[model samples]
Target: MSQTVFCRKYQQELEALPFPPLPGEKGQEIQRTVSKQAWEEWQAQQTRLINEKHLNLLDPQTREYLMEQMERFFDNRETDQAEGYVPPSR
Candidate 1:
């Protein structure tokens, strides 16, 4: 069975990531607190932000900005959205 964690974003027990998404303490923290579902959603949003804003991952500033956005996303705080993008209706 997959591991489970008390997701910080959802405030409930949910499936945890199999491994850290990045290297270092921040990644470990996320592995311990974030749910897989939440992480996946963040990935989709991150891709949207990159495509819409033309972000360059090689740039330190862009990486920092994305990190900040990731934290806000997991914290359930206000986060930036891609302009002119619409969510598909369920």
Candidate 2:
């Protein structure tokens, strides 16, 4: 069975990631606190931000900006959105 974590984003028990998404303390922290569903949503948002903003990942500032956005996202705080992007109607 998959491990479950008290998701920091969803604020309830949910399926946890099988492994750390990054190296070091932050990855471990996320593995312990963030749900897999939340991580997947963040990845989709990150892709949209990168594509819409034409962000260059090679730039350190761009990486930092994305990281800040990720934190805000997980914390349920106000975060930047890709301009002119619309979600599909369900």
Candidate 3:
């Protein structure tokens, strides 16, 4: 039941799976599963940093800016999901 043992047992099986992994987990998830402790620690640190540092800079305008940039990136996934195009991309 320990993580390392599980990884050694199932890593190939997981990697050879036919379907795509979840979106955020597309590539790194196998390693993440294999290295659960490191992954959790890294995620915790990243969450702490993002929540404490970058998130503090956010405001209504900051939200708008993020919406703008994300909409523009990769051909406007945001606007399509928005039920309509939105904010006119700035």
Best by TM-score: 1
Residue range 1-90, candidate 3, lDDT tens digits: 332423332233223323322355633453444334333433454344345445543478654654353323323133212222233455
* lDDT (C-alpha, whole model) for all candidates: 0.97, 0.96, 0.38
Identify the runs in model 1 with alpha carbons over 4 angstroms from their true place: none
Which residue pairs in candidate 1 collide? Answer: none
Ranking by TM-score: 1, 2, 3
Model 3 misplaced regions, further than 4 Å: 2-34, 56-90
Q: What TM-score, over all chains together, does every model reach?
A: 0.96, 0.96, 0.30
Segments of candidate 2 deviating more than 4 angstroms? none
The 10-residue segment with the lowest total lDDT in model 1: 1-10
* TM-score result, candidate 3: 0.30
lDDT score at residue 36, model 2, on the 0-100 scale: 99
Q: Cα lDDT for residue 35, model 1?
A: 99
